[model samples]
Target: MKGIVLENKILNDKYGIICIKSDEFAQNAAPGQFLMIRPQPYDYIYDPLLRRPLGICDINEKKGTFSLLYMIVGKGTKLLSKIKKKTELSFSEPLGTGFNLTTDKKVAIIGGGVGIAPMTFLSKILHENNEVDVFYGGAEEKDILLTHIFEEYSNNLIIATEDGSIGHKGFITEVFENSLKFNNYDKIFACGPKPMLKAVYDIIDIEKIEFEVSLEERMACGIGACLGCIISTIGTDPNSNSQKRCCVEGPVFNGKEIIWETVCKE
Candidate 1:
């Protein structure tokens, strides 16, 4: 699908949020799904060649708009940040599986850095019917950009920064772990760095609470045809691992079904 940029709000030298007007996307986009966006100075050029995958950060269905919150970590994102308003760009239809929404339950949501993008959308939808507790961590206070948005949807919000400039001085996982000992949540959902996800997986008791994690992988194509983004999971036979396409089968999966050893080794 093609969309026109409505606004490009740069939060800092390292991060920006691009809002696009796409009726189809706004109406159909689900939490945790992503878009394969091609960023180029000109349509005739294919310099970057591959479209970068970015999760849907926020969507305004009534306004027919969706936003992509990204950090300028590479050449593609650098180019994406320079794109001007009203510029038309091509996007893959909302790709990959989304988080299963639950209602009338207590849940914990964790996000770190750019991973916080999709969690905002998830929190927004989940909050209307469920009680949400959000834990967000970053390198510093400035990296915590989505608190205001999360605040509106979350029942409780916790922020952590490595530099001791935010709510908690250490990792957000540490805070989440501490919360687990005191509060009993019906479910837990997380999307962040591998280390953080691993930490969350280890901290939770899978038998007691349901948990889901959104995995991040580099993808060449946002479709199952490309084998570039396969991750190993426990196979049905239990003797070997199953390879699942992150673009097609997931960006979200049951945390309990994941092979932690394989995930950490990657």
Candidate 2:
């Protein structure tokens, strides 16, 4: 799908949010789904031939707009930040399986840093039927992305910062553990840095809370043809469901499907 950048505004100088007016992509976008975006104009040759895959942060159906919130971690994102309004870019969109939004049970979404992108989209939809809680953690105060958005959609909004500059003065895992004392959650959805995701998985597993995690992997081909973004699954036997594709089959997977030993906990 093709889109024209309507706004590209920097937030906290560390990252930026690019809102685009796209009739095709936005109309078909779903919560927690992503798009493979090439920030360069259609005529330009982007240094990296592969488009960067970004999660859909906001979907405004009424306005026919969608936005991507990205952190400037590498060259791909750096280029994305330079893109200006009215820039026409191409995308392969609405890819991968989004979160399953059902159930009247209690649900919690714990995310860190840029991982908060998809959680906001999920929170907005899940809160409509379930009791939802959103726990967002960042490096500092300014890193706490969008609190007002979460507040409007979730039943409880909690935040954590490494620098003690925000709601809770520790990792989001700490906040999650404390939250368990007061709330009995039936399910959890987490997306974040590997360590935080692992920690959340461990705790929720012990509590026997049904949960799913969204994995982040580097993909050269967003269509899963390159097999570049493979994640380990429990069934390790050959021809088994041992290797999962982050681009096609997921981004979201059952908690038990992940092979914890294969992931670096620390």
Candidate 3:
């Protein structure tokens, strides 16, 4: 883990929605990747273990800074929320394989909930050569954050919220499917809940549109040192099943290669 101090904190709400800017490991990070962080001066009374994994929200290479947007969901995150500017934090960064960008191709990007973090970086990368269309879904209006950043790279931006507080009163997949009908996209890139990804896979399975998905699993060690994040895959030797460690093999995988039935059922 690398120790770095926060430069700024931009709170999105009282629910512990925070965007932290730090000069930890910005230049080395890639889109759809993350950092495993542990708050410095560890509080054994409050936070026992190291910090949890946070996706790299955005990076400013020129300034050598990176950002992380997180909602305080648990004890660790709650402590993280209380941290002020200039407070030091430890980070294990540039972890996980990111999205694969195809040259000269138009792609549809889909994100749900906090999964939108990495998509912002992915959009920045894809904007260089490929046209990007983004579809984002959240529980409500407040849940949907970082719209302005995505708009910078997206040729078309669509939003969906369950409460109808914002854009369409439905799921992101609905918007994604609608976009598919009118656009000729070469591929689809997505990161979100497993159910949403399964739904997307079902649609593309029949339509035969090339797609890639980033999976989120509980990880013990950010690196492959621990086998805690193993996921099964259908590889050669069909009679014998194989496993791929999400920490190393992929947080990103080809949509078709994933054993969706087993993954979804689990």
- Against the unseen true structure, what C-alpha lDDT does each candidate score? 0.92, 0.86, 0.77
Candidate 2, lDDT over the whole model: 0.86
Order the candidates by TM-score, highest first. Answer: 1, 2, 3
Off by over 4 Å in 1: none
Question: What is the C-alpha lDDT profile of model 3 across 106-131, one tens digit per residue?
Answer: 88899998878778888888888998
- Candidate 3 TM-score versus the reference: 0.91
Q: List, residue by residue over 166-197, the lDDT tens digit for candidate 1.
A: 78899999999999888999999999998898
- TM-scores for the candidates: 0.98, 0.94, 0.91
Residue-by-residue lDDT tens digits, candidate 2, 1-266 = 78888999998688899999987787898877888988687546758677999988998888889989999988889989999899888889699988877779899998899999998888988888899999999889878987889999999999989999988898989988988998999888988887888888877754488888887888987887999988888785756658888888888887777876675541
Model 3 local distance difference test score:
0.77
Q: If ranked by lDDT, best first, what sequence of candidates would result?
A: 1, 2, 3
Q: Model 1 Cα displacement at 82 (Å)?
A: 0.6
Off by over 4 Å in 2: 44-46, 236-241
RMSD of each: 0.9, 2.0, 2.3
Worst 10 residues of 2 by lDDT: 257-266
Top candidate (lDDT): 1
